[model samples]
Target: MVMQERAVRTRAALIRAAAEEMDRWGYEGATLTRICATASVSMGALTFHFSTKDELAQAVQESGGAYMTDLVDGVAARGRPALRSVVDLTVGLARLLQDEVVVRSAARLTRERPDGHSWTLFWLPAVRDLLQKAADQGQLRRPGEPRAVAALAVYLMAGAEARCRAMIGAGGGGDRDVAEEMDLIWELTLEGVAAGSG
Candidate 1:
C-alpha cells in the first residue's frame, strides 16, 4: 500500500508539474527534463510511469477530460437547482480560465493538436440526450435537432472559455458581460433567429 501510494503521488506530482510548465512555456517549449526536475522525479521514474512524451500528453488530456466529467457529475448531485447548475457547468468554465493551471494547460493543448478535443464526437451524443431531456422538461427550447443544439451549446461553452482567456490580464470582462452574452444567445435560441423576432 505504501509503495502504491508513493507511486500515485509521483504521478500526480508529474501531472501538476507538467501542467504548470505547459502553461508557462507552452507545448513547443515544454520540456520533459523540466517536468522531471519540477516533480523531483528522475527520468527513469517518468519513463517507468509513462513510456513516452506522447503517452504523458495523452495522460494529461484524459486527466483533464476526467476532471471535467467529474465536475459535472459532482455538481449534478448537489441539488443546486438545475438551470443554475447548467449555467455554472457551462459558463463556470469561463471563470476557470483565470486559474494559472487551467488556462495554461488549455494553451498548451491548443499549441499541440494531439492534445486537443478532436474526438468529442464520443461525448456529443450523451450531451444531446441531456439537453433533449431538458427541452422535454421545458427548461429549454429544443429544435428538431437536439444533436445540433447540443453541439452548439458545447461549442459556445468552449468558445466562452477561449474568449475569456483572451481577455484575461486585461480586467475588462465581468460575469455580467458573460451573462449578457449568454442571455442574448438564449434569447436568440429560444425566440428564434428571425430578425427583430419578425
Candidate 2:
C-alpha cells in the first residue's frame, strides 16, 4: 500500500514538472531529462510513470481536459441564465489557464497535436446548448440567432485563451487581469444579446 501511494505521488509530481517545462518550452523543445530533473526523480521513475515524452504530453492534456470539464459542469449545475452562465464559464476557464500550469501546458499541447482533441470540443457544445436554452426562455434580444451568439461566445473565449498564452510567454504573469477583461467582453456581448436591452 505504501509503495502504491508513493508511486501515485511520484507520478503526480512528474506530471506537474512536465507541465511547467512544456509551458515554458513547446512540446518539441521540452525534454525528458529536464522533466525528470525538475521532478527530482530518476529516469527510471519517469519511465515507470510515462514511457515516452508523447505519453507524458498526452497525460498532461488529459489532466487539463478533466479540469476544464469539471469547471464547465460546475457552471452548468448552477442553473444560472444561459447568457450569465456563458460569461461565467469563459471567465472561469481564463482564470484556470492563467493560474494552472497544467492547464496552460495542455493548451499548448493541444495546439501542437493536430490529431489531439480541441479544448473547444469540451465547452463549445455547452455554449451552443446554453444559447439555445436562452433563446427558448426568451433571454436573448434576437431570439432567432442562437447560432450567431454561440459563435461569438466561442470566439471571445478563444481570443482570451490566446491572449493569456501571449502574456505567459512574455513573463507578464497574471498582471493582465484576465477576469476583468472577460467581464468587459461579457458586458458588451450581453448588451447585444439580452432581451429588451436596446
Number of colliding residue pairs in each model? 0, 0
Using TM-score as the measure, the top candidate is: 2
Clashing pairs in 2: none
Question: Can you write out model 2's per-residue Cα lDDT over 1-198, one digit (the tens) per residue?
Answer: 999999999999999999999988989999999999999999999998899899999999888888889999999899898878988888998888878889888988888875777778867888888889999999988999999988887788778778887886687765567777988878877776567767
* Model 2 alpha-carbon drift over 4 Å, by segment: 192-197
lDDT of 1 by residue, 3-50 (tens): 999999999888878777776676777899999999999999999998
Q: What local lDDT score does residue 190 receive in model 2, on the 0 to 100 scale?
A: 76
Question: For model 2, what is the alpha-carbon lDDT of residue 87?
Answer: 84
Candidate 1 regions exceeding 4 Å error are 1-3, 24-26, 78-85, 96-126, 142-148, 167-198
